[model samples]
Target: MTLLEWPASPGFPEPLWYWVEDWHRLLLWATDQAVSDVTLQANQPVVVERHGRLFPVTRRRLAPAEVYHLTQVIYGDNAPSQLAGGQDIDCSYEIPRGRADLARYRVNMTAVRAGRERGVEITVRTIATTPPPLATLDLPPALRAGLVFEQGLVLITGPTGSGKTTLLAAIIRHLLEDPHAHRKILTYEAPIEYVYDFVPRVHASIAQHEIGVHLPSFAAGVRNSLRRKPMVILVGEARDAETITAVVDAAMTGHLVYTTSHTNSVPETLRRLVSAFPADGRDGRLADLLEALQTIVTQRLVRTTDGRRAAVREYLRFTPDLKDAILAQPPARVVAATRHLVREHGRPLTADLDALREAGRIDEREYRLFRGLGTQADAISLPLPAGPDAPEPGEADGPG
Candidate 1:
């Protein structure tokens, strides 16, 4: 059908049973509506989240069999078997948008307890086809400077859905465009959210490998990248000790490495990575991590007065002096020491949020929400003075 002549699909039709093409059309419609997430469940109407609100887009609740068929259509025939084995499947799905572009989604399918019986629920997060330029992100000078290091570990960290992947993608796109950077970049992602096909590789070349589809794991991907002579490696997540160890090894061996983690701030990022190793070897691992550390950026997306979201970032660049200070501390004292260095040489998230509040970019309620999102331990761990709106210990706060 011609673009203009195509049927207008705001929601699903009356039919409870949908074809694979029907689901694709519905997703395209949701994308056009600026929906950020789509949810499908066994006994619920198809729902979409747009502008931070959720609403049903289908007239009828989907049957269990229909949901099963839809999973097969998006994921594959093995999705049912995989979900049956008690493993939630995380993968990427794509549909052609036109002759050259594709629309992509990060998909997760799991078996949910539906009124005492098992049923399926699928969550799909929409991703941009093209990565934005790094300049457009308006990262602070300190954070931007850390991105150019020849060889070290640069971590982009935050809670889930806090724009960590988007930020990392922009950094990779920046590297790919630099005329002086003529480096070979390799990326290991679970589902490969962003594709660099449209970005002109002016000097650097990149190859992206999906964890389950190509390599078996992130650790394996890092090890494999070494054999292929990559100058830069981007790892999707460094959650396990093996992957974290591999990341540190790659950095110490002179390959620039970029990775992400689920963390709240700079001090927490260091603690999480260092604590990943066994206690007997943690001191050595912490020393290696410190030696190879370049930067740690923790980001949070908060609502602005304009009704859109803005990123408030806290970051630390580990200069030689800062690294030495951290290394001098005992293992039990490293986190506290890092917090001290962050205040001395880096920008803290509270400071950024306060500036945004003063400039009227965000409302006071939004400010308080993000300001108090850190854990009680995080609040106690860092030695920085508390913001005016800092929450009490163990007090609940909104998502970061």
Candidate 2:
């Protein structure tokens, strides 16, 4: 069914078409339908993903020229020319909802092989207008306690689409909503996802900076936040060596820091961060990182039996004893030592998955898939039946 066949809602107009002229309306309709992502590819019908499945929204395929024009409209006039330079573009887009309201999206334009010619595909992930409350997240007691630190580093590690941003946002929202806690928070995100203007803050305040728009990179943003006198700093992701060093420095100088990394488990997260430094000074950097570390929580989203998804997490709060235990191990045994210590004093991801399966929150296939993986809990979600215009079998990519 097309957009017109869908019932009219409060702010949505009724006579919307499936063509590019009404692209914003189509996105709004997809949002209303609880779509998580929207894809626009050359010579393909507009597609939307919901509940880990993809389906087409438009009946007719979009021409190459139409997609090119659409790309220009979403980005700037130089978008197509920029894509021709063998580089993908990532930026944010929004539809004006009211005088001061907006529905923002994280958009990416990638160059793909369309027959012998180069084609463009635009993928858009919807951002929630406001972050959910931390109480709704049902985090473990240990994790909740670790968030009360005054000066240390807290990392939420996971792959893309694993709710890392959502988890950080909830924690930030909780800190801001606390009446007794008075502080300043600075955040640096690649493209700001969740806007917090509607959140009612008691005494805490926040300022956000985009990576490219406000600052050149994550490292620069971390360095910039130090001069702003914020009690807490949030770095979007600690990917490179420079950014990791900056995060460690901020934590060292008596400022609470929070960041995300694209790692699967707690031990791997530590290993990855320590390995980012040069080999000559790697041991020193590892000591600094372990000393300033407060907690590392790795999260993954698994498909549930009810067509939704649930977050399974592994977390560790690094006490002095645990830190010493890790440091005492040689380089070859560091990962093994960390794993043993985590199981002894922290929550392993396998236990959480087992609990979910026992409670019937997740099915047996999903549990076995996650349980069989190694330290890196990278497992593909079980494929579901697609919609009317869904892609052919084996064409669907799993969750990002």
Candidate 3:
């Protein structure tokens, strides 16, 4: 057994590494030692990063007996009998041995087969993370451009890990920097992320509340926000009918509101928000929602040439034409119409990618991969605002 040590800063913990260069043995060891509650990965090899350095680990298949023995190492000698009758089970434990330690990983183990072999594989990921920012996130310029609106709805949509919370934090920070924002800002998040330490909003008193931990859910957060008399309300997700209805009413009644969904595009965000209500709420409600909706931004982050990640954004600003389209109820046309507005009012994700390429900020392959359904910056294409519609480049803002 060999031990690898990482040099950590005075306030950080050192990374412990155990490299079994033999990939088969490494997989067997990982499978045996994985603890429940930790995320496990399959096919992909074990990768660990500490400080600024990454540790390389290998992966391979595991035999039942090897898994059993590994389980014994992780759970005690009796693990073999406990897992003997099961093919699918979730179990996890930590084994601390010397400097090469394992305690932080919450592992999920499952059964899989490659070709003719019925073997078990473990996929692993870390559970330790700082709570995601609730107010700031990566946002597209098109959606975030007119963020100063006093009363409207801004919507963000994506699956988890699409960085919705990060975008929200960026938005809050943008407003905090503005001297004109003198009203109170309140946010409701599930396990709030991005605690504001230093913001210059003189008139805005920012308050953050955690759902489940503080309130019941997002619906409750929205209802309570009305009582707070806030100028801006940030709902973590307008997921349910009550929350969507509340957010719509808030926007209509003149308090700007922001929220997120699990949809893909801007038009879909509109459809989803309206359809979330029953038939009663669906009647002419979408038009109202659209009228209050100032912007809907869809964005994703991709790896750049520098080995860091960069955001690409698709922008959609509310115009009289868009409001009319939503009232027509064939909301699907929204995407088609957005292409024109994207060209005219907001620059698309491809425009930013091209600009980054021209400036030598990103590479050709990187730009091409993130081009998405939009135009690349041409000689005539207006430049996209770097980061959120902020004053400089590389800044961030939330979609909602």
Q: What is the lDDT of candidate 3?
A: 0.57
Runs in model 1 lying further than 4 Å from the true structure: 1-15, 374-400
Task: Score candidate 3 by TM-score against the native.
Answer: 0.60
Q: After superposition, how far is residue 151 of candidate 3 from its true place, in Å?
A: 1.0
- Give the candidates in order of TM-score, highest first: 1, 2, 3
The residue-by-residue lDDT of candidate 2 on 181-210, one tens digit each, is: 797999999889997898999899999999
Per-candidate TM equals: 0.89, 0.88, 0.60
Please provide, for model 3 over 1-400, each residue's C-alpha lDDT reduced to its tens digit, 9 standing for 90 to 100. Answer: 2122432112222122222223223433433432111222333334543221345443432344454444445445654454444644433333343474333333335555534543444544332222333234444343456555888988877665555666777777767666777878889876565556545566567888877567888888888989988999999888877888788888999898988888655644655676676665565666667768887776666555544456666567787775665354333344344444566666566765776787776777766666653333332345664443232121121111
* Each model's Cα RMSD: 5.9, 9.4, 11.3
lDDT measured at residue 133 in model 2 versus the true structure, 0 to 100: 96
Which portions of model 2 show Cα errors greater than 4 Å?
1-21, 374-400
**Relative to the true structure, how large is the alpha-carbon lDDT of every model?**
0.83, 0.81, 0.57
